[model samples]
Target: MAGGRLSWAGLLKWSLSYVDGAGPSGAVSEEERRWLAEAVERHMMVDVVSRMREIALLMSTPPAVLEAQGITHDDIEDLLSELQVHVESIDMANDLHSVGGLVPVIKYLRNSNARIRAKAADVVTTVVQNNPTSQQLVMEASGFEPLLSNFRSDPDLTARIKALGALSSLIRNNKPGVSAFRLANGYTGLRDALNSESARFQRKALSLTHYLLSESHSDCSVFAQLGFPHLMMRLASSDDSGVREAALGGLLELARDTTLGNRSLLAEHDRLRRLLRGRMESIRTMTPEDLDAAREERQLVDSLWITCYHEPSMLRNEGLLVLPGEESFEQPPDVAGRFFEPMRRAAARRAPPVEGSDPGDGTGGGIVLLLGLAPDGRSNSPSH
Candidate 1:
């Protein structure tokens, strides 16, 4: 009978192994991480609200054992962060079946101390990055707009850092639905960060600019109007490669449209014309709206092509041959053929493509190339 009882306890312990497993991969195994995500989801359905509360209590508790079997307080912190992410993912997954009580759980998310708050920000980020619908749900459940005030105005540096992190997450994740105040905050915060003494702050600011430029291609025109050209020139030549790359990428996004592309920003347009002929011929005919909708998709495809085509050794190894589209070897071919599926899938569901639409109808099917020269006078490829 004692053996039987011990066997039952062992089974329970085995089943609960996942409770302590989810963490940074450099700290835990891939299988453990996957199992933890699944187990956390299962446990959420069992007694999710209470389980989270129990974790909160445990987070405040001391560790009694350092044995191999039981979890430590540090482990709890890591696992709590992971569970927080899982809970947010569940909330964001748009499953109507989650317990209604999950409403309070999200409210609880914004309650932790600075370190925990940063962890919460990361959880919010995962939701925002992966699922838009969840972002709306999180906004509704947590009054995340008001939470922004705490993150921004907190006197503590830790609090401020957490808030900045959260703001970046919010900015990146909530695109079409972001409020005007959020945009205003981003403009203010990013502008200030640009002037910050700390290089870390400056890097984050650059990243924010990249995210904004890449996702909100519509706003590129405003940048030029606001003298972003000078700012971008400085950034492109910054000591930091990341900053330079981001500035270049943002400029690329902006120059896709006629209003921006036709400007002096694209001084290397002739080189781009030669390199990107077939690749971006469709972009020449794009309406401004089409350019906006397809900017991110095009960036991804362009990155892939650059990776494949730029390295001669890789090209030969892959047995890939480049066929010039014209006798003059003028432009790249309609590489759009390679990108057709991704474009078709990315076509906005609510915004139907117009009938008999041209390449730039913003409905779909085209590529835009933006070319700029480096200060050294070395020309970049169309893919760049």
Candidate 2:
């Protein structure tokens, strides 16, 4: 009975004696408890280290063996997700490389299960995000190829997006990673993503494109070679505002390129000017919430406009930047007036027809905010 029964007497005795004092009760003092906590924490961290290595070994195990052990994609995903959380700490991120977790995580980018592949990319993303040490290690492991593979052709949208995100982090500040991307035709893959139906997918690709272009001013011509100018224009007009902004940002970076090749491509030529002009004129219908959200979009549009047209935005033209009621440094009047106003007035004097608008509307190259012309147009432009 004692050996096999519930042992209720023993449990009662243990519970009653469990008080925090050095008495018959098996309770330790505060100092002893603190010491115990320190030891427990150290042991817990040790366990974490062991668990990380174990997960890494399990991930490196062949899929066939894992399947035989009844480990499914979901199981692998959960394991990776946990590893990813651990890898967010910079120490743990470096520790992951030390423990050989990073490579296997990269390897799983080619895992048969779509969700597992995506989660593996997620782990890679976490590992390499701002960690140059891990970033270099990842590139050395030839992690880039599988990531590129998933980003280019993974059937799962999430997998593609996550893989793109991982690749982005991998190459961020690593010049060799960037060179590898160029050699591996990462931009072409990004172009494919831009054409994807997923808005987030397109946005991530756009951001990465902008970064890559920013890193190498010469890449703008690569984009023009890829016909990305026209593609970017289409994306800039996307119904999704984020997609539109990302695309516009990419275009702005293209416009800033001073390379002879970019100049030959004529990114800042009439077509872009007309596109920006039409976009500037179209913002009249945005609700306040939309306008607030779209300020960055408008700013990108404004910058791209001025870059191509060599004049300030309509905001500057309207004296909003110059004649602000309060003295603020947000828009310095000297910078605004010296470079922008004279050109705007000079353009106004000529009063050219808007390139993309109806030829006979007589609205001029810029938006006309004439009273009683359109009820909503005038009010929407000046408030911000």
Taken over the whole model, the C-alpha lDDT of each candidate is 0.50, 0.78
For each candidate in turn, the TM-score is 0.47, 0.72
Give lDDT tens digits, candidate 1, residues 20-44.
5532224556687577657655554
- TM-score of the candidate numbered 1? 0.47
Compose the digit string of candidate 2's lDDT tens values, residues 87-186: 7778888899788787788777787788988888888888899989989888888898999988898888999999999999999999999999999888
Best by TM-score: 2
